[model samples]
Target: MDSRVANDDVSYSSEAAISRWKFAVSRQYQHLLDKSTPHVLHRWIGCFAVACIYVLRVYTVQGFYIVSYGLGIYILNLLIGFLSPQVDPEIHDGPGLPTRGSDEFRPFVRRLPEFKFWYSITKAFCIAFVMTFFSAFDVPVFWPVLLFYWVVLFTLTMRRQISHMIKYRYVPFSFGKQRYNGKRASAESTSLPVD
Candidate 1:
């Protein structure tokens, strides 16, 4: 797959060029995430702080054209997961629904992995929040109305999502790392003693 998923705004013509960039960027990006992943509580707390700051700024300044657009995009991304089946229909999911006996051997793969989904949303909000400070982004509109609409949209979207999850029996979140036992029986290990 193209590293277009990583940075969608940028595009490369050649697969080789994209792969080279992916390899280089993933190492650095993975290192950053590895350092931060351990601090789960801190991460959530930081996210909350960023959100509160955004709300407070928007409330005080009454500027939310960019913020509203960002929220729309964010909600659309969330809706994508709710609408999509946990197991991708496109890929012939080799084994049937992964269960205890068959699941261990099967790789816990997903079409839209959780980390990428989250990173995109977080990046969007952060960029939008930064945009709030710039006067150019502030169009003269009643921000409270926009905020109200967002809240209503969020509620309706989540309500349907909960029902869909219950009906489908699928979880959108990825738990801890999927265990992959790579040990293989070599020819030497299986060969009989030569006498």
Candidate 2:
């Protein structure tokens, strides 16, 4: 009975140690993510490198076309979400993109935020890269057909998204655009008139 109790205690302590180690590792992972948040350009460059590596792997293997197709589709979905408004005007008539110059100027809010968009794309590529290593994911198909279809689909989707943007008069991007700071009061306007 004493030996049984001792074994149980040892097992419990080992489990507790494992739990603590996992917690510490997760906390460190989260910390790194937080630290990387502000370096948007760097993060994107890293993601681009990963994508390039994945593409190289697929091209060298000459297989996993299906996985590549799936990744492309997933990326298209992410792009749509990134370009879309949070509250779609077609669905709800609430505060949406201003149709006229007289209307209040509200910044465009995306359905999927930039950070989430980047993270999802990066993660998807990583998953597809991993899938490329396995034989089960390497289904054979005519690569040109898939490529052509993807191009057609992408063109149609972009046309629709552009039309939507034009119809709503909202540009999703803000870089190199004019900014209006409220008019500052002139010194003459504030000065008291001397008799």
Best by TM-score: 2
For model 1 the TM-score comes to: 0.54
Residues 39-74, candidate 2: write the lDDT tens digits.
Answer: 999999999999999999998999999999999999
Q: How does candidate 1 score on lDDT? A: 0.65
lDDT of 1 at 153: 74
Task: Give the C-alpha miss distance for residue 61 in model 2, angstroms.
Answer: 1.3
**Superposed Cα deviation of residue 49, candidate 1 (Å):** 1.8
What are the models' TM-scores? 0.54, 0.87
The number of the candidate with the highest lDDT is: 2
Q: What is the model-wide C-alpha lDDT for candidate 2?
A: 0.91
RMSD of each: 12.6, 3.2
lDDT of each residue in 145-191, candidate 1, tens digit only: 77677778778877876775565445555566455443544655677
Off by over 4 Å in 1: 1-30, 79-85, 88-112, 171-195
Model 2 alpha-carbon drift over 4 Å, by segment: 181-195
